[model samples]
Target: MALRVDGDSPQNFSALFDLRGTADTGELRLTSPIGSTLGLARWSPAEAVLDNGSRTYRFDTAGELIRAATGADIPLDALFSWLAGQDKSVPGWRADLSQVDAGRINAWRDSPLPRAELRVIFDTP
Candidate 1:
């Protein structure tokens, strides 16, 4: 994913991920190029935590956990929708699911200042 937040330089990242469970309580695992685990984020209503092999970090909510890692406020609810092929709209983000079947998804945000963009590539079972 490549993200451009209005005032800051773009942030780019690529990984193999597995997101399981519901938005309220789930696990998001990030893997490296050679298929090694990089980080694992797990969240519930009361708390969110990330175990990165070496250490662990904690946050108050899933949103905070995401922001801390990606520097964006990614609504988990909307994310789940897109993953399921729903073109659901959010206040500041627009998603292009046209190529989802081809293993790609693109989304961008342009509201509340510090505009941002997100691109994802995945494999479907």
Candidate 2:
């Protein structure tokens, strides 16, 4: 596992993920120096569960079952668009879509229900 910032290599890094359960599920939580959650990816291999808190999203990755759950063939672009739209309601939250690289975009575009990005911003009190 690696962490990058603004497309540059990260100077500091930390992460927590557990893969010991029978469900084969794990959660990754990473925070940058600026106090923003750079990434959070979770998956349940047993049940094909996927979720990312930054975007308030939850979905299953159980093959065709996921499509059935959503009632549609959801594309990666649509998922990212949906996640981006969610930031609109978050008072201090913002996402820099421009910073997303081609590799990242392609990876998600190719996956059935890929991980979502969340670039959090902190506001002064």
Best by TM-score: 1
Tens digits of per-residue lDDT, candidate 1, 58-106, equal 9999999988887778778888778878888899888999988887888
Model 2: per-residue Cα lDDT over 17-123, one tens digit each: 22222213444345555666654445465444434333444555433333432332333223234334322222222343342332221111222323222222222
Name the runs in model 2 displaced over 4 angstroms: 1-23, 46-54, 62-125
Q: What's the residue-level lDDT of 105 in candidate 1? A: 84
- In model 1, the worst 10-residue window by lDDT is 1-10
Models 1 onward score TM values of 0.88, 0.26
TM match of model 2 to true structure:
0.26
